[model samples]
Target: MSEDASLPLFPLRTVLVPGAALGLRVFEPRYLDMVRECGRRGTGFGISLILDGEESGTPATPAGVGTAAVIEDFDVGADGILALRVRGTRRFHVRRTRVRDNGLIVADVDWCADDPDVDLQPEHALLGVVLRKILERIDGGDQAFPEPHFDNAAWVGWRLAELLPLEQTDRQLLLQEDDPDERLAMLLRLVDIED
Candidate 1:
């Protein structure tokens, strides 16, 4: 782990993985300011799953591992809330956190390495096929996702982990695993794909 750097933290109930897209409706004044600053600076904020507390009033306790979220699209909703589409760019491990006077949670975090590409093995063929089918269903007769790398083990694993109907804790565990192979193997087990 590298030395920690401070990042604005958004502790939500969901976990985000690198390359995944998340839509957020911003209503709170503190987060609205954070979003404005992030957009102005063209920088991302950190998203960590909330360990305790709610998203509305008080600052929540965030989990250790988190993902960096880059704003991809922004608009003002009819209700006058800020609606933003953000993509997960990278992973980080929170070292420590503190609450700012304005109620935004800032954290000192160490960035995690991106998953290395690995060639898909024959044993993992079923997992790849399942992932492709899921994407197709989500796309609804059109390819909404970018060109997929079913032949890449790391990509396949990340996509599967993202699309699977797994618990937040389970997804968080997969995100924290540093090894792509181990992550895929764990997914296989979670999906009850026996060797």
Candidate 2:
């Protein structure tokens, strides 16, 4: 997150949580160019949930707090579409924003400290079980979630927050929260994962 204080901004429709995997289809010219630039520079871009406007044609308003996504894999299809796979690395707070002529937005953002890994206490064991079940159900098996961190409160909460079908606003709220235990509470109340 320190290589460049100013990372390219992408106001996306979905919120990217730290340690979560997300796949995006790049079709818009601005985004296509963004992928190329990020690839060439070997730098990641910022992803914020769009607060207003559309994903294309207009420079949508974005949430001030966002996640820095490091590109993991990419491919170009026969239709000239760029398929991007990314992993959220860290959370950031936007200091300023500006749009390019091509409608790309770049921002000066400060990286947020990662949540300290806290052992998942016994009270929250149900949450861990739910996350494990969801991960196991995905067709990719372990590939869907990679290495699971059932003992870490932050990792369990983030995985559930991403895998569950909760509203984007709720997920964005979880992303902005600084406390892993608090985030876990919110997810437990939202999904009622407890029996």
Candidate 3:
């Protein structure tokens, strides 16, 4: 992840957690241009959850923290639209934003530190099992976790956050959290409450 710098922001209605996969359709001209530029540069774009406004026509309010995403695949959809499959790589904090003449929002952001490599504690092991079962039930469930890291605390928590039916705001809070054990603890409470 780069240090403090500027990045192109794509504001959406949902939150994107690290180590997860998301699909997007590019019909907006501004975003289309961004996609072309990223592809040309072999670089990724930043995705922030829309805090206000819609996904088109104008610049929308975006969350302060978001995930950096890289395009994994793209194809023409049945409607002849460009469909993109992106994977979240890292988290970043938006220092500020600017709107280009074309209506694209670019943010000056600082990359968050990588999650510490903490082993999954025994108490949190059930979360991993639950994640596995949920993924098994969903179609293409393994797409978000191409390689499993069930023993890693942060990995399990992030995968669960992506797969769970938590509210977008709740997921955003999880993304903002800096401690993996704390995040996992919160997930445990959320899972219990959801149950």
What is the per-residue lDDT of model 1 for residues 1-195, given as tens digits with 9 covering 90 to 100? 245677899999999898888999999988998998887887889999988999879999999999999999989989998899998888999988889899999998999877887888887888998997888788452444667788988888888888899999999999899988788888988999766
Candidate 3 stretches with Cα past 4 Å from truth are: 140-146, 193-195
Tens digit per residue, CA lDDT, model 2, 7-117: 788888899999888998889988888888888998889899999998878899999999999999989889888888999989999999988999899998888887997
Compare the candidates by lDDT and give the number of the best one.
3
The positional error of residue 57 in candidate 3, measured at the CA in angstroms, is: 1.5
TM-score of 1: 0.94
Ten residues in sequence with the least summed lDDT for candidate 2: 1-10
**What is the model-wide C-alpha lDDT for candidate 2?**
0.88
TM-score of each: 0.94, 0.93, 0.94
Evaluate model 3: give its lDDT: 0.91
Model 1: which ten-residue window has the lowest total lDDT?
A: 139-148
Q: After aligning candidate 3 to the native by TM-score, how far in Å is the CA of 61 from where it should be? A: 0.5
